[model samples]
Target: MRIALLTEGVHPYAQRAGGGWCRRLVEGLAEHEFQLHLLAGDGGGSGGGGGAGEGPATYGPATYELAMWGRRPAGRGPAAHRRRAYVRAYRELVRALVLPGERGSFASGLYRLAELTRQDGALPAFLASGHAQRVLEREWRAPGADTAAGQPLVRDVLVAGDLLEQCLRPLSAPWYGPGPGRLGAVDLCHVVGGGPAALPALVAKRLHGVPFVVTEHGLHLREQYRSYRSAPYRWPVRALLLSFFRLLTEETYREAAVLTPGSAYDQQWQQRCGADPARTRVVHEGTEAVGREAAGVEPEQPVLVWAGALEPGRDADLMLHAYARVRAELPGARLLVYGEESAPGYLDHCKAIAERLELGEGVRFAGLPESTAQAWAAGTVVVFTGLTQRSPRLLADAMLSGRAVISTEVGVAREVVGPSGLLVPPRDPAALAGACLALLRDEERRARFGLAGRLRAQERFAVAPVVTAFREIYLELVSHWPAFPAVDGADGGVPRPFARPAEYWVAGAMAEAH
Candidate 1:
């Protein structure tokens, strides 16, 4: 398939755990030809609105850069009138979302920008603006809301609408190409997630006749709102900013040809936002294989561990709060955190909570490791209370390496953890503390849960199966497109999936090979 792999900022530049899944899709679907269009947050910077859509992308034996975001340019560039027009339109649309009463002008402005972009070569000047950040702020503080909806209705809708217009620079991006130095041609519009990456896809579907498929790893826009809650912006401003995403998600559900949430829980939320049940698929994120003998790994002590980015939403703070309580019952208990940090102050916030609880010595800040499963195998019990409503589950291999997982019943925790693990509600440290204490007290049960989780990860979320499934999707998409483009020798037409004889791996022998 000449797939236009639409992404926000993960590709071209390396982001720790962010680009893994998209890379998997690109590599696994080797049978299908793909045209990559990576995007990065303008971060309101001065970078090219478009990138060269060269030839076939190169992939190493294991990793490929998933172009998610475009890099910001170093200096200020010239602004174009065409770009300014789009900014106005987008801002107005955002104002409409946050403050519905501004509909008349916002609607009028949005269509005008869309109409302009539909013209031949009209995207460049608009996508070249440096005012995106300003636009974002402008709309957050913009106008009228329904008093009863309990959402946001700040100062003036027109001002906010203008701000959104400036921020909607990507709509003017030349990358959404009908030519070279553009997004290129593709059989399907495959969006990696629904935040910044999916935003471009939404526009492409609206402006072009492209068919879009959405596969959400997590709820991107929701996480953004949660992170911004404590920002310097007024509460009313935060409330208003949320309307931007609620509306973005709504658009995603409507335009996407198919919606695939990484977990069933994500699927449910997509439904709430108006996704058709038949179009939504629950495809779990699979783990890259690490060659290690996992059939037998000994858990020596009563330890609790959590693995994931140290972000606000990971619920790391809640885990720290719970650990303080757990240690009262078992003074020797330890909580180890192994993952990179995210968000400006989230890591420090978690550490502060640990210090305040006086549970300093009982915790382990084991830093992120290359092999998440190896890190997970070190624990006797895994304490997973991070917010599940939006965060994607940890690599299935890590979860399966077993430590009794105690997660909030969000996303696919119930399905992933199944009966072998304990479940808890989010934000409840007391319940989390109790679950950790139970697993810490029982060594044999921990061993069983770990093995069961390992087996399940192998059976359900392993890399091979994910590759197989995606290869199929690629073939289906490619079959519909006549041929690949001429750039860099990409032979289009039907890039066949299952084109070669399959190689099978028997159980125990597999981990050793990985």
Candidate 2:
């Protein structure tokens, strides 16, 4: 079967983003063909020498076809006709955002803009125009509009417009409508993330009767809410943008053939955001089992390892406080932080906190390790202090390495840890310290927990089973998808033979053979 894997700001080229997961899926299912429809972010720039259809060299050999679509160029300005159409369509879209009852108008306006984009190819210019700003202002100030009370300023409108332009740019891509080497030809469209990444897949399903599946590793709406809450924009601007995201998610959830959340925590978020419970499934991220030798080794010191990017979400400061308490009880205890810095200045801040606490040699930032096994081997206990997480890969690695894990109660951490590891209340350094101390003081208990963790990882989080589940989902979707009618004589009838059950094909083949 051929699959179109849709992604934004990830895959085919990105080194750290969701690229690794996409690469794994494509590589694991070698029997099927994959076409990567990548919607490049601001940093992604234009497509390389591979052009639009061929995979880039960064992704290695030609296992899958790659189509790169980038952000609209800033230089090209829209013409008078296109600008007028953009204004009308954008006005309608904003109205739908403010008034939930106008969802049909929202879909209509969205597609109208898509149509104009196809004809004029100047969506970027339209979004940059003063007319777009006027349209947003009018909608925000409209009577009964939720944002009317906030009274947005000119700067807020401009910033919001810029953000909206980026989000809606996917509609202008050539891959949306019917054509060769586009979404219309794929057997299934599997979106790797939510929000804007799933927009094209939504269009493909609506326009061509294709079945699209959404696999969300993180809840896009929750991430957006967190980001926009702290944004510099005014309340009105934030409200407008958030409303747009909420609407997008609602529509995507309603239309998707299946919603695959990486964990039950993520599944709950999806359902809360209006996803049908019948269409949702929890598919855990796959983790490769560690070698027995690596799992069996004992560390030379009583080391606590925290392995993840140094970001605000990781709450490294809380970890430091907990370690300080642990050191008071166990002076020989060491904390090994093994990961690259994700947020600017976060690593320096963590180091400063450790120094202030006089944890000189007690704490060490080991940066990136040569291997996950090596990192886990350097520590007796694995710790996670993140305030929020969605089936973190690091925790799975720690469990697979047969280490006793001490994690804050967060997204699926408790569920994943089960009885194999200890869970502490998030943001409470005292609780975190107590948990770590408990595991450190009892070597026998630690060994038992480690063994249970190793067994759990092998049984539930192993790569083979997760990959097999996805393969089955793809086959099931393809077999039941509504077939589109043939446009000409060369085109076959609607509900193509591929959509028929395997038994039908096998029976026909047997009769032919006889």
Candidate 3:
């Protein structure tokens, strides 16, 4: 079967953990042909010789690489009739964003704009034009509009217009056409999360009746909300942009054939965003299982390990305070932090906090470890201090390596840890320190929890189960959907199961052998 994998920002090219996961998914399902529809944030420095539709040289071939994104060139404005059509669609779209009662027009307006984009190649340039900004300003300040309260300035209109143009640029992407290599020809469209990345799948479904599935490790709407809260925009601009995102998420969730959230927490977020519970499923993020030889045997000297990107969300401050408490009692306890600082100055901020607490030699920033198993093996107890986590891949890695874990109660942490590890309230040093001390003092309990955690990780979070689940989902979607453009000819005809041979579930195992 041919699958269109839609992604944005990170995937295949990025060296980050998110990119690693996408690479794993594509490589794991080797029997099926994958048409990658990536929307790179910056369409440059890919080390490849050319631009969009060219996969990185390592992958070999344009069919596998249909990535798009770059600075759009300024062009002539739309023709007279086309300008009127643009105004109508842009007005409806902004009305849906600024007027609460007109929210239902969002889908109609969005699709209309997409159709216009397909017809007019200059849609991005048109969106950046004064005509588009005028349409947006008129709607934003119209009677009963939510954003009118802010009395938006001309500068706000320009910035908001620019943002809308960037988000809607996917409407102009070339991936939606019908034929062998387009999204219209795919047996299934698997979108890796949602937001603008979903625009192509949305367009394909609207134009060709294709069904698309969305997988969310964390709800993109939630991420947008968090981001916009700290965004340096005026009330009108922030309100307008956030409304677009929230409404877009609703559209994506409402139209998706299935929503696979990596954690139950994200499933709840989807439901709140208007996703049907009947169509939602919880599929935990998968990871390669750590081998027995690579597993930790429990470190000496009562050392505690912290893994994951060093960012504010990881709450290194809370961990330091908790460790200070642990050090006060145990005196010999040490905390070793492993991972790169994701944001500039975050490492120094953490170190400063440590100094203020006088943690001294008791704490050490060890940078990223050679391997996850090695990191887990370096400490007696693995501590997860993240205030929020969607799937916590490192926690799974630690469990697979057979280490006792103490995690702050957050998204899926309690679910992932289950009965195998300790949980504490987020931001509470007392609870975290107590849990750490308990595990550190008792080797037998630690051993029991470690064994249970390893068993749990093996049963649920292993890569094989995730790959199998998606394989079955793709088969089920294709078998039941008769309108799939790829299956039916120009003349309506009976639908058939995917033409590909039975999936080779051993692809991962074979790759490991090599």
Q: Which candidate has the highest TM-score of all?
A: 3
Across 1-514, the per-residue lDDT of candidate 3 in tens digits comes to: 7788777764322211245556677777788877766666645444221234556554332433222434554446678888889889888899999999999999999999888877766678788888988898888878888973688899999888987887787787766665546777777788886888898889988887778999978677777777776677898998898899899999999999999998887888788889999888888788766445536456569999998889899998889999999999999999999999987999999999999999999999999789877888888989998989776566778888788999998988888888999999999999999999999999999999989999987878878788888877887877666544442354245343463323432464688899
Model 3, residue 54: distance off in Å is 5.3
The residue-by-residue lDDT of candidate 2 on 299-353, one tens digit each, is 7679999988898899999999999999999999999998899789999999999
lDDT of 1: 0.60
Candidate 1, residue 477: CA error in Å?
A: 5.9
**Model 1 per-residue lDDT tens digits across residues 1-514:** 3466666653222222345676677677766665555455443122343544232334222111222233322333323655666567656665565557664454355556656665543433333344544564455544554323343333433333333433354555555544432333445667776654565566655544456677777666556655665555445444554565566677668777777787877777778878899877777777655234563455565777788888876888888888888888889878889888877887788888888889867887878776766777677776666675444446355655655567877667777778767888899989888888877787788777777776777677777777786666655544443332423323344343322212322333686888
What TM-score does each of the candidates earn?
A: 0.70, 0.84, 0.87
* CA lDDT of each prediction against the hidden true structure: 0.60, 0.77, 0.79
lDDT of 2 at 439: 91
Instruction: Give the 10-residue window scoring lowest on summed lDDT in candidate 1.
Output: 59-68
State candidate 2's TM-score: 0.84
Best by lDDT: 3
* lDDT value for model 3: 0.79
